[model samples]
Target: MSDEACRLDVWLHRARFMRTRALAAAFVEAGRVRVTRGGVQQRVDRPGRTVRIGDELVSPSAAA
Candidate 1:
């Protein structure tokens, strides 16, 4: 992780993907989120994971 990186949960919440940081953390911890870094995709099982500007995040669509 670089200095430009931020916590997964913090990024998610700041991006308005989740209503709260806690919810984002839960979503990540549940393995519902995947991150692509350096061309490799992997599950994000921890909220503390760092996400940089180029990182791609994938998550299941929320039920409507």
Candidate 2:
């Protein structure tokens, strides 16, 4: 990975998505998080999705 490449898990955790790395990985495995760029969606499997600043990230909506 390059220095500019930020892992999805790391970004999620840093951005305060999940409490831990394991949780972030779990969310990805469950197909809850969607990483999108250029108007296309990509499912993230690991922490190596290479996220950049201001990238769109969509997760499953919370239950009411």
Candidate 3:
């Protein structure tokens, strides 16, 4: 991952998708988060997954 990349959980938390980083991590581990990069979309099942600035993320909780 590049230096500009951010962890999935951290990004979610920072973006206010989840109230806490732990919650974000759990959401990701449960495969509730989908990430799209380079036009390819895939479920992110790990909190450690790297997310770049242009990456798109989709999660049910985020819509709430």
Could you tell me every candidate's TM-score relative to the true structure? 0.90, 0.75, 0.84
Residue 1, candidate 1: how far off, in angstroms?
A: 8.6
Best to worst by lDDT, what's the order?
1, 3, 2
Candidate 2 segments whose C-alpha is farther than 4 A from its true place: 1-4, 62-64
C-alpha root-mean-square deviation, each candidate: 1.8, 2.1, 2.2
What is the lDDT, from 0 to 100, of the residue 22 in candidate 3? 97
lDDT of 1 by residue, 20-56 (tens): 9999899899999999999999998999998898999
Best by TM-score: 1
List runs of model 3 lying over 4 Å from the truth.
1-3, 61-64
lDDT of each: 0.91, 0.77, 0.89
RMSD of 2: 2.1
What TM-score does prediction 2 earn? 0.75
Better of 1 and 2 by TM-score: 1
Q: Candidates sorted by TM-score, descending order?
A: 1, 3, 2
CA-RMSD of model 1: 1.8
Model 3 agreement with the true structure over 1-64: per-residue lDDT tens digits: 6788999999889988789999989989989989999999999899999999899987774446
